[model samples]
Target: MAVKKKLAVLFIVDLIIIWFSIYSAYYFRFEGKLVEPYVNQMFLYCAISSVLCGACMAYFGMYRKMWQYASISEMFAMCQAVAIGWALSYAAASVLSEVRVPLAVAVRTLETSLLLVGGVRVIWRVIRLRQSSGMDKRIPTLIYGAGDCGALVAREFKGAAMADHKLIGFVDDARDKLHLTIHGLPVLGNRTDLSTLVEVFKIKEIIIAIPSVPRSQVSEIINLCMASGVQIKIIPAINDLIKGKISVNAIRNVDVEDLLGRDPVHADLQGIADYVHNKVVLVTGAGGSIGSELCRQVASFAPDKLLLLGHGENSIYTIEMELKHKYPGMLFEPIIADIQDRKRIEEVFDTYRPQVVFHAAAHKHVPLMEKNPAEAVKNNVFGTQNVADCADKYGTERFVLVSSDKAVNPTSVMGATKRIAEMYVQSLNASSRTRFASVRFGNVLGSRGSVIPAFKAQIARGGPVTVTDPQMVRYFMTIPEAVQLVIQAGAISQGGEIFILDMGEPVQILKLAEDLIRLSGYEPYIDIPIHFTGIREGEKLFEELLTAEEGATKTQHARIYIGKPEVIQQEDLYVELQKLNNVVLGNSEDLKDVIVQLVPLFARVS
Candidate 1:
């Protein structure tokens, strides 16, 4: 209704302008003395001009545009509409009127009408901008880049919805752009000047609008802003921008993932698509962090069908709904079955005959698995054996197991089981036609039981955040980064090889806790105390990506390396598994000892 009223008002105003323009043209041409014949035909000329011009304006969608956010395209449209309207109006007047309208008068009328019509919109847009930006309470904000993305951010802030923010200017690093103006906002200075600028301008908010740069650079800027004690926001990642365009709604708070100081992962797109496209892909534990991310990335390649298999019904249902919503046209089948149940696993394999299998189902939490060693073996060892055997039986082309850095010289029951799982797949690959491999990486930053969420929860409670140990350190990567490399590893796998991802650097738990505290707007040990608890059972000071016995060699990808495959005696592995199976079924207590025989590097934490 408001739009209708606004359009009606604009139409009435345009009609009046059309009539006034014709009269003005004649007044200017006859030196303020109106000629008799022109005056007599003025009413007929006005009627013809108003009707034709109004129709042209409607056809050009002039009244439909939100002039408050007008651009050059809107002005161009207005010019075209006015010119076409007058051309048609002149033709009609020459044919239907007794006196011929002067050619000079016709041209002058078009020029006058265009100026008045276009001027009204431009003035309205300027007035709206002034009214919105005139807010006295709007927070003074500074955009951290003066490039394309920064200019886009400035443009979005001009809307009424963003009236709460008053853009001061941009801060750019390029020497040439340092003093230039972008979108009428000046480029203040580089990152080093942030603190002084914040103090001088009393800047309450700083928006990091440099989305195309490396995250490390962003992290550096964020740290600089941290010293300014101002609220900081960042634009979405380059790929996350909608259709490669930024919106003010997409501005978000900086996350711990950004603090990792790593660039976005670049996967071998064609390689992954080649194997995954049109193939029946199956992801075990598809509801879990790594598994769900795998499903999302794989869905992009347009798989024939993505089988989401998990033990928990709720988790499986959640992922199924998500996939269905995200990839509506793609086929997705959510299966609720346990990998530990051999029959159920076999049934799923027989039904789908999935060409690509990503085995991510396993017991992973170190402390929990320490207390429940037998369950860990049942799921991580025997469960994996069941999946791999089915893959072999069903003639699957490729099978990739999601292993962990803990699997190397494992100190925990969980890690030992994962190591044992890796061994089984390697042994199976020797005889099976399927290419079996494993992707081993360190701790996923935001996985279900990872330390990141624990720190956040403690911080939210306004108390001491707990750290396992001050000295304990582990390599960390975001969940998406890990899953991307996992898929890429699958694309480049040969049978029996274990691929290790480059988990940038080992981060100390103490430093990580401090960073999290600062990111949460609290000073460590001052605002939020950090307490160090001794390391838990089955955890180590550091995790190794590869055991000394299995040295690594560089792969085709810079971030991936191939660990030398260990030769496993197939008969010996079978006998040990049989004994372990008996121990589990008999409820025996020697589970850890039996696991030692399978993974010789297993070191009992006790």
Candidate 2:
């Protein structure tokens, strides 16, 4: 109802403007003296022109436009409508009357009509913008980049009804763009002048709009902004924008992963599809972080059937519902069975015969595994053996074990068990038809029991976040990134290869804690006290991806490397594994001694 009323009012106002414009043109063209035929024909001319103009404007949807956000396109549209209306008026006047209208009068009327119609819309737009600017409490913002992205962001801030940011200016490195204006905002200076501009404009936030640049450059810009103590946000990449996954309102806070400054991982899509497409893929521990991500990526390839196998019913159900919602047409089967139960696992394999298996089930907590070595053995070592044996027996095409960096020069029982699992898989690859490999990397940022989660929980409780050792450092990667490389590794697997991901530089745990505190909008060591606790049992100061014995060789993918350690003979490995299995079930006190014997590098903390 309100829109109809608005349109009616707009039509009436335009009619009035049209009538006045025609009369003024006649008065001006006659040189301030309205003579016989001109004065006599003025009312008839006004009526005919007004009706023609109204019809043209209505046909062109001129009244339907919201002039508050009008642009050059709207102005052009109005001009076209006025021109058509004037042409029709002159034709009608020539046909209906014996007296011909002067050419100057017709041309003057066309010009005057266009000027009145176009000018009102533009003025309305400017007035609305000024009124909105006065009413809105906009935050002073600095846009980093003077290209298309920067200009789009500025326009969005100005015209978006819900936008709360007021763009002060742009900061670009292009020499020629400096001091130039975009969308009425000047390119104040380059990034080097960011600090000064922040002070000059009292900038409360900085939006980095250049998504095509490398991560290293983005990190550098973020560092500069951090120094000024202003909040930072980033635009999503071009690909995301093109896919309709992001918009101006989709801008988000910078994550810790962005600080790594590593280039985005480009996976071998053809290789991944060759193995995953139209194949039954099973991922054990499919409810866990890495396992769930593997399922998602596998589904993207349109697998014949994705088998989500996990021990926990809730997690399995959760991922199942999510996949169903995301890929409603894709087929999936969710199975709940513990890998430690050999009979159950073998039965599942017999039924499905999945061509590819990603084994991610294991006890990952160091301190917990240190206290419960037998449980770790049953789950990590024997659990892996059960899965690998089934894959071999069922003629599975590929088996990828998700290993960890702690397996190298191990200090913890969790690490030792992972190393033992790697050994068993490598040994099985010798005689098995299934191509077996392992992907070993370090901590995932948001995985369960990782340091980041612990720190966040501590910070939430308003207590001192604890650090085991001031020097402790470990390699880290985002969960999705790590899973992508893992899938790629599985695709390119020959046999018995341990693929180590190039997790950029190691991050100090203490520094991570401090950064998390700050990111949570708190001052480190001031708002939240950080306490240094001595290293716990089964913990180390640093982690290694490869030991001295197992040197790395490069692969086709720059981020993945192959490490071929000295393999244990299958017969000998099975014999040792049998004895270890008996010890695990019998509750012997020599558990650590047996583990140390198998993994010579294993050291038990006293």
Candidate 3:
């Protein structure tokens, strides 16, 4: 507190020195030892000007900040004070008839005022340099970009509490900015200097501010920084920035979820709440990511009763506990039962009598599902059928089947099974009062089995981030965002509706790996090796949200679109499914043939 008071006093002294300099410089410029009878009034004018300048400085918050390590806004504040002082001096020295003043003298006074007032800030800056010269600054950091974000980062490091982390300049992809100074920090070359910079400067952290840069590029930088032993973090997306949540203090570690390859798709909170508000809702597979998200979202809609159904007891208990904690007043029943057991599902439907049901139970991993095609068929196909049929039988108002993007002309057994689930819902809708909908989307980023966790695990292990194929691409949406869409889609459901979400553009898998590496603060090739292991079975080069023959018609909601599939006879589908079930159970040799018959274009495990 004493040091602060001394600094404040020093600031006032500097301002006074500037004020007198302006007064004396003008006095000399006029080339006169004032002999006028009203000369004493000039001292009065100086006094008034000094007080007014001080008042202006206060208004601009100049005194609140350290002027020696002042901000650009502070400099602008100084400029304002000087300009106002000159205007006031002009009025005092010349405008009043009682005052003996010349226009030429007033001009000199204005010129000198600017020089002195501006000089105070200039001198203060110099004093800081002198004060800081002998101090051994230790903390080292790397700013990611060479552009405006980099400059903002540099400026922040110059401000309060930034002393712990010394700015070691930028690591940019653009070669043109090499050796350039951004707020006194040099653009120390390209990303190639990452490891070297950390080693040379003993860099402890890297702050990435390139929000608009591709996730792939951002990942590259994070990997570089992380590999170099520098902690890597990024600025939040534009939304967080616009909300003023972004700051040096707000800097956070780079999340592996960012490599999911799409911006957050904003959810329809009201639209979702409208459907689930005070209504009974139940979610199968409530322990799984998609199911868990559905449960959380439904609970937010103020559902009177939320039933959490899953085969895994621990998972069901976990979700039930979480839902209980989050929504104290709401009813949550955690039921542990496999969907394959129709009796258990029927009993749950009878007990809950839920108005809305989200069936998300399924084996989703493509390769795993390929290995256990019968299991995929049983869980994804039969499990969904059992749930949807139970909902229809129980007179549930609506049922939403969680479908996948690979369901669109799917080549994988998992995708085909999910597609079969969609077909079952469509067929079930035809025979029942329940309005069933299938929300088809691609991958949910950060989901239990998603690539994001895999990449994160690999990165955490040090090296060799694996990529199935450099060219592979997939549509991705955040789990929350996807759930939001599913909610809205369920609300807008009509019988037999297959709702497809807008997944934005697909992102390259190889690029995702690269970006994940970068986010970890490692150079892609130099520090973290991205091993391309070739495309896996059931892995598509690019995933589609809709089948080629299917087209989406706009619904009440912008994000949800209705998918029109090739017309199929419900009787025929049921008969075919029965045969598929028998074949899966009896003739394991005919499993591939049965899968292909049920889901055309379904590739058998090679």
Candidate 4:
């Protein structure tokens, strides 16, 4: 009903405009005097112009446009409608009446009509701006980039019906754009002037709208903005943007991922596709963080069939539904079977006979696994054996174990179990027809039970965020980056090689917590307090990607390297595994000693 009323009002207004434009054109063409048949045909001329102009305006979508946000495109559309209407009306008036309307009157009418139609929309837009400007005093905000993205963001704020922000100006790095007005907002100056502008304008928010630049550049800008002590928001990188259009709601608070300062991982697409494309691939622990991402990335390569196998039925069902929705034409098989069940594992292998396998299932929490050493052994060590033996028995082409940096010279049962899993896969590669390898990396951001989520939860509760130790440090990677390198490792694996991802400089845990607090719009130690809890059982002050005994050699890819650790004899490894199995089955308290026998480098910490 509102639309209909708007259409009716606009149509009536446009009709009046057309009639007045025709009469004024004729009066002006006659030099302020109306006479004879030309004066007599003025009403006929007005009627013809009104009918043709109204039809052309509707045809050109003039009535459909929201005049409140009228722009250059709308002006161009109005011009086209007016020009076509005047031409048609001139032809119709000449044929319908004996006294022909003069050519000057027709041309003058076209000019007058275009001017009136476009002016009215602009006036309406100005009136709306005046009304909305007085509606409320919005927060003074500054956009960080003056490029295409920044301009779009500024326009959104200026043109919105009830925008909560008032765009003060833009601060760009490009010197050429400085002092120029964009969308009625000035390009105040470059980044060096950001602090001064914020203070002068009493700015409340700084929006980083440069999406396509390098992460290091963004980090630099963010660090500068942090000095100003205002809320910081961002337009996500181009890769992160939604497909169709960017909205004001898409402007989000800066996240820890943005602070990582790591550029996107450029995987060898052809290499990954060669191994994953059109192959039957299986991913264990498909409901967990790494496993689920593996499924998403593998599906993008158009695999013949994707097998999502996990012990948890809900996780399996979730990834299965996501894959089905994401890849509507591809086939997916969700198997709810634990890797520890040897019979169920073999049955799955016999049934699907997947060409490639990514074994990600494990018990990985450090302190929890320290208390539950036997369960870690049962799942991480023996469970890996069950999957590897089945892969070998079923003739799978490649098997990649998702190992961890904690596996290097471990201190905890979880680390030792992962190290054992890597050693077992390496020993099996020597004798099995199926190729086996391990990919080792550090903590993935936003994973289940990771420090980032824990810190976020603590911060959300508006209390003291707890840290394990003031000096604790750990390397981190985004989940997609880790998974991409994992798949690439599978492509380049030549059996028994442990691939170590190039995790950048380790981040200090205390500093990370402080940054999180700041990113949440709070000052560390003042607004949100940090509490230091002593390091828990089975954790390290620092994590190593490769042990000293297993030095890394460069691989073809820059971000991935190979660690040729010393391998154990197949019979000796199985004998040790048998001993570990007995300890776990007997529920012996001395499980750590047995784990140490298998992994001599493990320095057990009480």
Query: What is the Cα-based TM-score of model 3?
Result: 0.68
- Per-model C-alpha lDDT, please? 0.90, 0.88, 0.78, 0.90
TM-score, prediction 1? 0.75
Number of the candidate with higher lDDT, 2 or 4: 4
Candidate 1 has an lDDT of 0.90
TM-score of each: 0.75, 0.76, 0.68, 0.76
Candidate 1 clashing pairs? none
Write down the RMSD of all candidates, one decimal each. 12.3, 9.9, 12.2, 10.9
In candidate 2, position 295 carries an lDDT of 90
Model 3 poorest ten-residue lDDT run: 238-247
RMSD of 4: 10.9
Q: How far does residue 228 in candidate 1 sit from its true spot (Å)?
A: 3.0
lDDT of 2 by residue, 1-606 (tens): 887887788788788887887788888888889888777566777788888988999898898888887877978888888889889988887666557777888887887777777777777788988998677687889999988887777777866652667778899999999899998889999988988999988898999999889988887887678767788888857664553234666677877777767788899999999999999999999999889998988999999999999989999999999999999999999999999999999999999999999999888999999899899999999999999999999999999999999999999999999999999999889899999999999999999888888998999999699999899998999998999999999999999999999999898998788767766767787889999999999999999999998999999999999996686987877788888988998999889888887899998777
Please state the error at residue 170 of candidate 2 in Å.
1.7
Query: What's the true lDDT of residue 548 in model 2?
Result: 93
- Model 3 lDDT, residue 545, Cα: 82
Q: Which stretches of candidate 3 lie over 4 Å from their true place?
A: 1-163, 167-232, 237-249, 256-263
Give lDDT tens digits, candidate 4, residues 1-606. 897797688788888888888889988888879887887688888888888878898999988888877888989888999889888988999888778888888888887777877888888889978887677478889999988888778777866642778788899988899889999889999988888999999998999999999888897888789778888999987854554356877788998888787788888999999998999999999999999999999999999999999999988899899989989999999999988899999999999999999999999999999888888999999899999999998999999999999999999899999999999999999988988999999999999999999999999999699998999999999999999999999999989999999997898999889888888889889999999999999999999999888898999999999996685898988899999899889999888888888988999787
